[model samples]
Target: MTAATVLVVALGEVRSPVLESVTLARTLGTPVLLSLQPLSEADTDALGRAGVARALVADLGEARHAPAVAGRAVATAAEATGATVVLLPTSFVAKEAAAHAAFLLDAGLLVDVATLRLESGELVGGKRVFAGTWETECAVTSPVAVATVRANAIVAADAPEAVTTAVEPLSVDATLPRGLVLDEHEEHPRAEGRPALAEAAVVVAGGRGTEGDFAAVEELADALGAAIGTTRDCVDEGWQPHDAQIGQTGVTIAPRLYIGAGISGAPHHHGGMQASGTIVAVNVDPDAPLVQIADLAVIGDLQEILPAAAQAIREHRES
Candidate 1:
């Protein structure tokens, strides 16, 4: 049978990729239901803007941080709405939740899918594999499909007309698994005036060549309104935070534009960013691996090149 209904699961704090998933769901020609934990008025407004007609709001209380709990809630919503496909944004928590939801529903799971389509009444997904060296398509054979979609997979669009979403409260019986307890939790303050690294359209990253100095990289990132990322070496050297590190061991990004400075493009690092729409490499070494694979290679000291590029961008914007 064709996909009759689609479910898009997101956190209480709406993310851009969640909206993009909603936009993608609309194209499936199915009834789309949003599942949010601790829904808020802002979320409802955003849903209306995204053209969502219904939402399943769950109040997970203290168990909100538990992926299993979230996953159970998602499964319940999918069952209640008769959703054949469940879509979520790719994140650490979302990945775990998707896996758990798929297990509960006995559905096929796809992670970090770059594109999705309906073919012959089946959900098909395209993804890169083997460290982004090869592309492959996967079709879900189960009755239900759960997929965690990557960022920049689809551009978010606003609806042609406004919609008032009908909100429904979902009750989840699932709780924290046995022997697992959340004693305390701490929320970190987010960096201001910059977009989230995982969701940024443009990313400016530095590496060992920065010499523990990220001033130039920061300036260039700010000039282009881009997020700042760093290689594992930079994070290990304390030049950047662990959250800023992009690699197999850290976060994977698929920004529209990625600029690498002083990076050697190790396989681990390449796996994280190889899906970027365009890559530009700036390094002093003419034969750096990043330069070799970059769409544009600039041979120069990043300290000099970055500042000059930032200056040019600022000047052009003012002119």
Candidate 2:
């Protein structure tokens, strides 16, 4: 008999891609869950709705601190369950953690899997390579394959259906490594309201076309109830905060809607937001590379266009 396949999912602040993975997992066999924390009743209900077993334990606790140590413990727990495939969010920490775990378990690591499937009795996944320019399919059958999935790329469904799912909570004893805490800063109260380009559903970004005028960028974002972003030039000019910038060196966003104002539509910039569902660029040059990629291109100065567009959206939403 062949080894039964299992996909272990880690819970993080990022939305789970359970639906997509579960659909893909069905093409293989039973997909059981390996949770890190003791799930609450609500979490249990969610897992039950998805028709999967819940194996809860205190995860590595890397969200707050201790990533390296947590990696070993998490990897040990995963190996103990004999999970064939491990799915996790694709973050800097998650990637490092997954890499460390796979190293410990002596498995192959497939970072940032955009798609997954069973091919020729092996697991095949689509990965974004070379800053999203090249897409390649990778397959692994190294006893257990570790993968980190990108958020917003797939819908998650933890609906429990079959009652035969064996719910098992895990317990492991591991030594806590000494960590250096240089400083502890107080949490901001209005942090949730802060415009985060990575997590923003919609992002309105400006570039050199703004020429130091970011007032309209913020205005447009507020009108649309979206987050504001900027290009390298804009950030360099001190027109906007570095945190709101989106480019090769800045935050990457895959928002549902991306509005580019006065941006030259540089390829480097496009690399950051190419995953956006709908792209709209407003530029006077009219022949920028992004113009071809944009769903709608407006040939006009951004200063005037931004305000008018913001007003129009505000009116439309109010109506």
Candidate 3:
């Protein structure tokens, strides 16, 4: 069947991809949002502001992992709503759930999709391949399509008005695979009170030149309301967590603005963020490879450069 309703599966807060997916759905049909957990008041308000048609939640209920439970919940919601297309944010958790949902529905699945649309009653997507060296278009021929969309690939637009949300509980079979049991689990100490790296409009990243200090980079990121990232070298040196690393081995990002400080722009690193709308490189070496790809380059010491930039932004915002 042609896609007539879109089911957006979200883990926590409504990500930029959800908004974009809704926007695309509006062009084709109706859009409804489904969450794994109950939406907070703030999250509900944000969704209303973004103008989603309906909102529903399904508790994971004592689960080994979020994806396994959440995926079945999504399938149940889709069946209840008659949604023919399911859109998930491309986070690790969401991707896992999307994969599970595809298997359950026997639907075609796509990941890291940069664009989506309906052509001749089929869902078509465009994605980056070959380490960002090529773009490929693919279409889903199955009755239902499930896809995980990249964050920040599309601009979000406000809707005319907020719709009254309808909430429902979904039933999911939670039999664990291989009877896996949690022996022990501890959450990592992630950065707090800051924008999430994947959804941030701006990002300030440090590299080996940081020399085990991130004070300057953090200050700059705070000034710009940006997220912080670091190179793999910094992660290996225990200066930053592995989650903060940006490269082929780490998370891929496509922000409106990306600023690199003391980075040499290795291929692995550049391949992850080369799709950024704007790139700025700051390094003492004018011959750095990062400078060649940057829209703007500042040759100077990071100690002097970062502080000055933060102060300038502060003064500009105040004025």
Candidate 4:
């Protein structure tokens, strides 16, 4: 029997989740093929250390920013590599691309996958559903499987020894869809040195309890080298941008460590972060829903607690 091949698709700057996908692919005992844009020397070296057997580089140009175009490239690479399973890092663009690839490949598509394994020669993904209250396992019955994986789902580890990754150019149809045209795009400005919220292993979030001032939250996040997130209420209040909101209507994250301040732990918000490996909640309301589910709960005013916590962390590191 021919060995199964797994394709990991990553776009733009390589992130931790992308490395995790590569690690998972290696764990599958399959020939791992990486489909991505042209890489720099650093990225190429990094992938080699991560155990990529081969890389398929597609020059999508401006179309690289478009999910539909990237999806086409992913599909093309999968076909060329004879990949039976495709893994993608969970992001807005990746989710869209997964849909497009699944449609083109006639594969079973799974999103927000937190665990993946091969069961009886079939790819099975474990994910949470119904606002993070239910866990289910889905096995792909189709010839091919495509899944978008959440960050921190798997720990990234280096290969036993670095191997030279053969690089091959992949051709993709860069034509835009009808009525779509390339336009100027602007990347959202993030705090210097802070990780992206969606992919960060540690996240510190604020809510309306901060009363529109995120100073405490920011300090703590900075001290911990963590990403900053906010509740929907904070976004509506203009305390933070929409991209920072974490809720059912906003971004879903499953970081290793999540610290929430002044959050009520509403079902909508909990649903988004319930998958976090560890949850710490700081709020004045002892009865807050978030406090109930938190692995560690502190009943106090965040304005006072956050700064103190940040200071203690900084002092410990310095000491």
TM-score of each model, paired residue for residue:
0.95, 0.77, 0.93, 0.95
Residue 117, model 4: lDDT of: 85
**Ten contiguous residues with the weakest lDDT in model 3:** 181-190
* Tens digits of lDDT, candidate 3, 176-293: 6676664554655546656677767799999999898899999999899899998888999999998888988997888899999999999989987887889999998998989998
Tens-digit lDDT track for model 4 on 1-319?
A: 1227889888776678888888888866554555556777777788889888688888787788788888888898889989988999999889998999899999899998988888877788998888778899998888889999889998988888887888888878989889888787778977998999899999999999999989999999999999999888889889899999998998888889999999998887887888899999999999999999999999999999999999999999999
lDDT of each: 0.87, 0.68, 0.82, 0.87
Clashes of 1: 0
lDDT of 2 by residue, 95-158 (tens): 7867777888777788877787776767788867776778798888687777877655555654
Error of 2 at 56 (Å): 1.6
Better of 3 and 4 by lDDT: 4
Candidate 3 displacement at residue 246 in angstroms: 0.6
Q: What would the TM-score be for candidate 4 when compared with the true structure?
A: 0.95
Task: List runs of model 1 lying over 4 Å from the truth.
Answer: 31-33, 184-187
**Whole-model lDDT for model 4 versus the true structure?**
0.87
The candidate 2 region of ten consecutive residues with least summed lDDT is 182-191
